[model samples]
Target: METSTASPPANGRVHHPGLRTLVQTTRFHAEHRPDTAAVICEGRTLTYDALHRGSNRVAHALRAAGLGEGDRVAYLGKESEHYYEILFGCAKSGTVLVPVNWRLTAPEVSHILQDSGTRLLFLEDEFTQVVEGMPTAPPETVVRLSAFGTWRAEHADSEAEFEATSDTPVAQLYTSGTTGLPKGVVLAHRSFFAIRDALASEGLDWIDWRAGDIALIGIPGFHVGGLWWATQNFNAGTTVVAMRAFAARRAVDLIRDLGITTACVVPAMLRMMLTEPGVSAEDFTTLRKTVYGGSPIAEALLEESLAVLECEFAQIYGLTETGNTAVCLPPAAHVPGGPLMQAAGHPYPGVRSKVIDEQGRELPPGAVGEVCLHTPARMVEYWGLPDKTAETLVDGWIHTGDAGYVDEDGYVFIRDRIKDAVLVAGENVYPAEIENVLEAHPGVAEAVVVGAPDERWGEYVHAFVVPVSGHEPSPRDLHTFLVPRLAAFKLPARYEFIDRVPRNPSGKILRRELRDRFWNDSARKVN
Candidate 1:
C-alpha cells in the first residue's frame, strides 16, 4: 500500500518506482502525470487521470454485473484506448481480461469464448453480426463498443477497494491451438513488470524506456508481444500509440507524425514498412529503436532494416507462456554481418535458458534440442488444462517447443520447431488446425499441412492432399470452403494434389518429409 506523491522522480522519469500491480501503475501515473497521454489510438487520446477514473468506473460496472474475483471478461475487438481501459479495470476489480483476436472466424472465436467460460463479452460494433451469426451462444451480458461509453458512465468513477497481489492473474491470452484447441495462458501482474525490474537493477539499456518515449504498438493486443510491449511503456509512464490494426502505410505515417521513438514489431511488419511506397529513413528520424521478433528474420531483411531504419534494432524471442520475451538480441550486438545476427540472443537479466533432449535431460552446448526458459515473467498456467500445464511448464521452466542450441558463448540459435506449428507473419498456424477442416471436404480423402518459406510472409501454410477418386478438388474450391472456417492467415497459400500422403510404419504422416521439400534449398529447416 506504499504510494509516491505527485512529485516526479529526480532522474526526470515519470513512473512510480514503488508500483507493483497494474492497478498501482495506473493510480501512480494518475497522481503524478494526470494530464499526460497514457494511450493514443486512431486520433483519440486517453489521459492518465481519465484512464484511471474511467477504469474505476469500468471496475464498478464489472462488479455490478455479478462478476467476482478470477471471472473472465472477454474483449472482442481491435486495439483501442477502450481496450486498455477495460484491461486496467479488470486488474483493479480482480477480473481476468481475455482479449480475442478479432480476425478469427466465428467458430474459432466461439471456441475461445466457450473454453474460457467467459461471463461477459465486450463486442465491437462492427463484429456484432459475427457474434450473432456464431453457432455457439455468447455470454449472457454482451456490451457493444459503441454503447460502452454510456454503459461505463453509468457507474461511479471512484476507486474501488480491492486487494490484489503481484501474482494476481490479470490477462488470459489464448495460444494458437498447436494441439487442435487453443489454451488460455494465464498471465499475472508480475508478467508485465518482473523483467523490467530485473533489467532496471542491472543498469542495462537493452530495451530501455525514456520519459518522452512514444511507443507504437505495431502488433495486435491479442498477441503477447503487443500486450507486453504496451504495458512495458505504460509502466514507465510514457506515451503509447496503438494502431486499430497494423497497416504498413499507416504505421509509417504515425512514426513520422507522432514522433514515435520506439516500436515493437514482427519481421514481416518491418518488411512491409520498408517496401511501403515513399517510405524513407527520413520518415524514421524520430524512431530511436525498433524491437522486432515473433518470426525469424532473414539476413537480407535484417540488413535492409538496419540501413533503412538507421536506428537501434533489438530482436526478441519467446512465447505467450513465457510472458513474451525471455531472450533479447540487444542493440549492441546488432552488427551488420556479425555471427550473433543469426542467434536468437541471450536471456535477459534474471532469466535462465537451456536446451533439453526428448527425455528432459539438459543438452550440451552445440547440441540441438528443445529450448527451455525460466523467467520471473513466465505465465501462471494454462487455464483449465492441468496435463498441458504440467507438460509444458515444469519446475518453473517453460519447455519451448522450439528445436535450438546454445553455443559456447551462450547465444541461442533456433533451427527448427519441435512442434508442428507454422509461423505465418507472426501468427501461429498449426497444421492440425488446417488439416482438420481440409479433410472435412468430400474432395479431400487425406490432407497434411506444413510451413513453406516465403519472401513476403516469414512462412506460408502449404497443404498436400490425397483427392477422393472422382471428386478431385482444385485449390480454389478448397480455399473457398475453408475461408469461412479459418482465419485468413491459417489458410494454405499453396496446395499440392497427390495420390497419397507420405507416412511411417505406425501410420503417422511424415509432415517433415513434406515440409522439407519446400525448405531443402534453404540453409535452415525453419524459415
Candidate 2:
C-alpha cells in the first residue's frame, strides 16, 4: 500500500535524509537495486548502478565546465535515455536543464537558446545547422551528443560538491507558443513529483506501478509530460523503455514484444498505432495502464482502444506550467453512459481547480469561464517574462487560456482555447467542438477548425481535414455529415483538404499555422 508517513530509506548513503529531490530518488534506486534495468533505449540498456555512476560523471563534467547552481544548460536532441543522465546530474549539481524542441526552426531554436541565456548546450549532431544559421554566435560551450562520452571521461565519476533542495528550479521547458512567441517555463523539482507524493499520501497508485512495471515513453523530450513521465517511473525504480522517435509500427511491435506495463501517450499516437498492420488485441496483453492527454480523444477512438487494449485509461489534463497532470479521468470513471469522458475529471490530490470570469472572480459550477488551477506542481515562473508571468499566474492560480466550466462534482469540461474561439456573427464557436464533429465522419482521419477572414460574418469557420486511406472526403461530404451534428453557425463555411494536421512536438494541433495561410494578405491578422 502507498505509505507517506515516513521516508522510504535508501540502500546506501542518504542523499537528502528523506525523499526530497530528484537526485535523492535516483540515488535510492541506484543503491537499492544496483543491477536492475533503469532505462532501455535503441540497443542500449542502463542499469541503476550504471546510470548513477554515469550521472555522477556528468555532474563532475558540468562542474568542470563551470556550471553550478542556477546556471542554465540547454539540450537539443530527440528523445534518448541519455537525457535521464543529464537531467539527474543537473538535479544533483543544482543546474537548470533546458530541453529545446529540435523540431523547431533555426530561428525558433535560436530564440530559445538566447532567451534562456544558457552557458552551455548539448546539441545532437544533426541539429548543428540550428546554431550555424543563428544571426549571432552560438553559446561558448557546445558538446555534440556523439562525442558526449569524451566530454564525460574528462572528469571522474564523483558526486558534485553542490546539493539541490526540493524547491530548486530544475527544468526550463519552453511552451509551443501557438498564439505568439514561446516562453520558458521554470519548474522546480518538487513541482515535478507533487502528484506522486500526494498519491503516496492517499494510499493510492494513480497508474498502479507495481514491482515489475515497465513503461514506454513516446512523447518528445521538449515537453514536461515526456520528462515528467520518465522521472515518475524512475522515482519508483521501474524500468523505462525509451524511444528516439515514435513510429506507429515500431510502437506496435514494441508493445507486443517489450512487456510495456504502463505507457504515457497522446491521443494521436493511439490512433496511429491502430493503423499499423498485424496489430490486434493480443499485442497489448501486457499493458495494464495508459495515460493519454495533449488533446482530447474522440469517443470512437477511445472506445476502439478500450475494446482492443483492455487496459486502464487515465485521461489527464494539464499544461506545461502545471508541471504535468493536475486532473485525471481514471479507468473506473470511464463508463458507457457516464460524465467522465466529457469532463477532465476532478483535480488530483493537492490540486484545486476552478472556473473564473474576466475579473478573476470565481464562477458558479455551470458557468463557462477560464479554467484555473492551483497546484503544488505549478511552475515557478515563465523565465525572463515577468510581465507575462504575472498576467498568467495570479495569486498561485494559473489562469489557463482554456474556456471551460467546472461541474458540481468538480469535473472540468474543456471546450476549446479561449484564444482559438471564433466569433462568427457574434456567436462563440470552439474549434475543438467542430473538429470533434468532423472527426466523427467515417472517411475523415483528422480534422481541425480555424476561423478565416470574412467580409459579412466578421469571421467564418474553416475546416482543414485529412482523409483516411483510400478515401477523399469532399467539402460537401463533410458538410453533409456535420450538418446534423453541429449548429448552423458552427458548421464549416469552407473546407480544405490537407495532408495531415500539423502538430507540435507535444501533439497539440498548430491551428495558427493552418489559419495563417488563409489570412496571409488579409486586412486584419486575427479573424
Candidate 3:
C-alpha cells in the first residue's frame, strides 16, 4: 500500500496542555476569556462565561431528569447558540450528544431516535409536529428550543461534579445512509482536539485559528465538518458566528458586516454565494481564509472563487469517521492550473494514509485503489453495529471506500466513491471524471453522472446536467465539447436537463436518489 506519514517538528510543544477534553477546554476558556463572545447567532451573543454557566445548568437538568453517563440526548434543531450550550453541557455531564439533521423526514428522524435510544429530545417549535407524527413513539422527554431558556433556568448554574476523560464519548453523529438506515458514528472528546494537538509545534497554517478571528460556521452543526470547525475555533478562544440556515445573500452580509475572517463551507455553498446577486469582492475583504470540502470542486468554480473572494482557500477531505479532516489541501497549493490543484492535499501531521488494491495489497504511487486513513481523531465505533465497525475500522485504519491514489510527494487524489464507478464494457469509469468535465462547460452550471443499465455495455453513463442560467447546451453540443477531452468510453451516453441537482443538508450530491429511478425494476443494480 502506498503510505504517507509526517514526522512531528523537532521543537514541537503542546499548545494547550490543559485543554485535553471538551469539558476542560470550555472551562479553561471561561476562566481565561470569560467576557469574549463564544458564539453569535441571530442577534444573540453567548459569552464564554455565560456558555459555561448555561451548559452547567443543562448538565444539572440532564442529571435531574435521571440521565447518566453514556445516555443519548438528541438535539433536533437548526444552528443556534443554545445548541452549543447543550453540546458542552453533554460534554460536561457525560451524556452523548446526538445532533439530528432537521431536514430529515419523520421516519428517518424516528429511526435515529430509536437507534440511539434517545431518552430526551431537544427540537425547534416548527418540528414539533414532525416528531409527533413519527411512526414510532418519540423520545419520552421533549424540550422545545422556544422554551429552552425557561427550562434551563430551572436548574442551577453550578459546575457538575461529574467528570469525563478525553476518551469519553461526547457526540454521536449519524451518516447519510444512501442505501439503508444511517449509522451513528460515536466520537470521543479527543476527536475534537487530536489534529490540533499534533500540529501545535508544526506551525503550519493549513487550518489555523487565532484570537479576535470571527469564524463563520456555514455548514450546519449536524454535519461533522460544521461540528469540528466550530470546536476548533472555540478551542482557540475565537468568536464563532453561526447561521440558523445557510442563505447565500445572508452569508455575504455576515462576512461584510460581522467582519468574518475565517469560514468553513462546502463547494456548492461557495458557488451559490459567488452567483448571488449584488455580491462583489468588497463583501469578502475581511475573509482571510476559507476551508471547503464535502465534494470535489469544479476547476471553473475554484477559479471564480479565487478571483472573487480574493482570499486563501484550503480544501479538506475526510469522513465523519475521521473526525471531519485528516487531509488538507493548503491555501498555497490552490493554483488554478497547477498539477496539485486536483489533489486532495497531504495528510495532516499525526495522520497516516495508504492506498490498497482489490486484493488488499498495497498499491504503488499513482495506482488507483481504495484510500484508507489512520488518524488519532478517528471515531470510536459505529454505535451498536459491531459487524459494520469491524468491516470499516480494520487494524486501526478507516477504509475510506474512495477510489484514489497517493502521489510520490504524498499528495492524494480522489476520483470518486468506488461503488459509484460505472462499468462500461468492463472498463471502470468514475462519475466524478465525467461530472468534472461537464461542470467545466460554460453552459453547464452543475452535473451528476450515474450508471444506467444497458443491454450492450452492461451499464452506460447517464448525466443529469443543471444548465447555467439563460444557457442551454444541447446533447450534440455537450458531446462535441467532451469528445476531445474524455475517452470515448468515458463520455456521457445520455443527458437530462434539470434546474437544480438534489443534495443532502451537507451539500453532497445524492446520486443514489437519481440512480435508483433507473434501477428500480432492474434484476441487478450492476452488471
Candidate 4:
C-alpha cells in the first residue's frame, strides 16, 4: 500500500548478513516505514512496525513457554501472516521453525512431529482438532493463533530478550519424500545471508530492492520460496503480500490491486495464471519480474507467460538442501531463443556449480550428468542423520541428484532428476509412500510410483501396480483407497496395472524406464 523509488546499490551486489544479525534495513525500516504496509493478506494488512512488534511478542511468548535456541517449534497451519510472524519470531529467538505442510494426513503429521521432536506447535483454527487428537506429539505445548482465545494480548513494542545470531538454525524444512522417507533439512542463518549474497553476485542487481516493492508470494510458506523470499524482502526492507495459497484468480486479483512488482511461481501455477478466465494483460502491468522454478517450465508455457505477463521472466533452480536457489537464468537470457529456455543460467556468487559423473569427476559442458552445488548457502546437514548427511554433503558439495548440463556460455540446463522422486505439481511425492499405500490394498501385490511429464503440473504421479493373486482393483478402487490416506496432490493421476514393475538385479524399480515412456524427447506430457 506504500511506494518508494529508492533502488538498491547498482553493482549487482547485495551485502547480506545473518537473518538476526542484519539490522541495517530492518532497524531503518522499523523507524522510517513504521506506518507503511509490510505484510498484506486477504484484505488484511500489517504495517512494518506492527509486524516487527508482533514478531517480538511471539518471541516473548515462545520463550515464556520454555522454547529457546536449537529448539524445534512446529508451525502447523495455512499460509497467513501468522506463518511469517511465528517463523520470524523463531529466528529472533534462535529457535528452529519447522513449518509442517498443512495438507499432510494426521498419521503423516504425527510422523513429522515425532521425528523432529518438535517441542512446541503453533496451530491455526483448522488444525486444532488434528493436534488435539495426537497425544504423543512432542509433549511440550500447543498454541493456537486466532483473535478469540485465552492467549494474552502479547503484542510487545520492545524487542524480546532472546539471543539471535548467524549460526542459529532458522528452519528445518522437510524434503517432500519423493525418493524415500522425508528428511529434515537444517538451514542456518548464515546460509540465508549466503544465498542473498550469492544471488546478488550472479547479476541480480541490488537496486531491484525498492522499499516500496510489493512481492506477490503465491507459493506455500512451508516451502523454500516462502522462507527465502520473505528473508530477502525483509532484508531489503520491501513489502510482502502473502496469499494463503495459489489460486490463479486470487493471484491476478492481488497483482492488479496491490501493484505487485514480483512473484515467485512454478510452471504449473504460471500456466494457470496465463489461462485464468477473464484475465487481461492490463491486470499484470505493475508486475516487473516473474521468477519461475521448482520444475522446468516448458518453452511453450514460458513464451505464453512472457506474452501474457509482459514482464521480465527469470528462471532459478535449486533444492531445499541448497537453501532454494543455486543457479539462475536471468531475465535477459529468457529471450525467444531455444538455448535460453533450457538453460537455468549461471551459478550464484559464492556458489560453485558443476556437472559431475557417478565417479564424482566433473563433466564437460554439454555432457549431461548429476548437478552438483557448493555454496555457503547450503544447509548444514540433515537433522539427526549423520550418515545420510555425509552421503549428501561430500567434499564441500551438496549432490543435487538432478541430471543437468552446462552450456559453453556457462548456463546450466536441467534434464531430469536422478533421484527416484516424483514431482507432482511441484510437490515432491516419494514413490515409496505411494507404493506403500498401494500395497496396503488387498488387491495390490507390488507397486511403484514414478514421475511422468505433464503439461499442467510439469510432472504427474503415475503408479504401476501388480495385482495380488485372486484379487484386482481398478484405477477407481485405488483412488478411493488413497483418498483417505494421502493428500489430494499426492494421489497418482494415472494408474497402470502392470505384470511386474521394471527392476534391476537388486529389484529397485527402474523409474527411468517408467518415466521414459512419457518424458522421452518431450518437454512435457500432459497426460
The best candidate by TM-score is: 3
lDDT of model 2, residue 356 = 85
Instruction: Compose the digit string of candidate 2's lDDT tens values, residues 71-103.
Output: 999999987778888988888788999999988
Q: lDDT scores for all predictions?
A: 0.86, 0.84, 0.91, 0.74
After superposing candidate 1, which stretches have Cα over 4 Å from the reference? 1-15, 420-527
* C-alpha-based local distance difference test score of model 4: 0.74
lDDT of 1: 0.86
Off by over 4 Å in 2: 1-17, 522-527
Per-residue CA lDDT of model 3 for 1-527, tens digit only, reads: 11212223452222454577878767877887899999999988999999999999999999999999999999999999999999999998899999999999999999999999999999899898889889999888999999999999999999888888878999999998887889999999989999887666567778777657899999999999999999998887889999999999999999999999999999999999999989999999999899999999998899899999999999999999998899999999999899988889999988999999988899999999999999999999999999999999999999999999999999899999999999999999999989988999999999999999999999999999999888999999999999999999999999999889989999999999999998999878897
Pairs in clash, predicted candidate 2: none
Model 4 C-alpha lDDT per residue in residues 203-320, reported as the tens digit of each score = 4652245546789876677888667777777776678888777788989998998899988887667766876779889999999888777765546567768988999887778888
Runs with alpha carbons beyond 4 Å of true place in candidate 4? 1-28, 132-135, 147-156, 199-203, 420-527
Clashes of 3: 1
TM-score of 4: 0.77
User: What lDDT score goes with residue 299 in model 2?
Assistant: 72
lDDT per residue, candidate 1, 132-178, as tens digits? 88899999999999999999999999987786899999999998653
Better of 1 and 3 by lDDT: 3
Window of ten residues with lowest summed lDDT in model 2:
8-17
**Residue 327 CA displacement from its true place in model 4, Å:** 0.5
Evaluated against the true structure, the overall lDDT of model 3 is 0.91
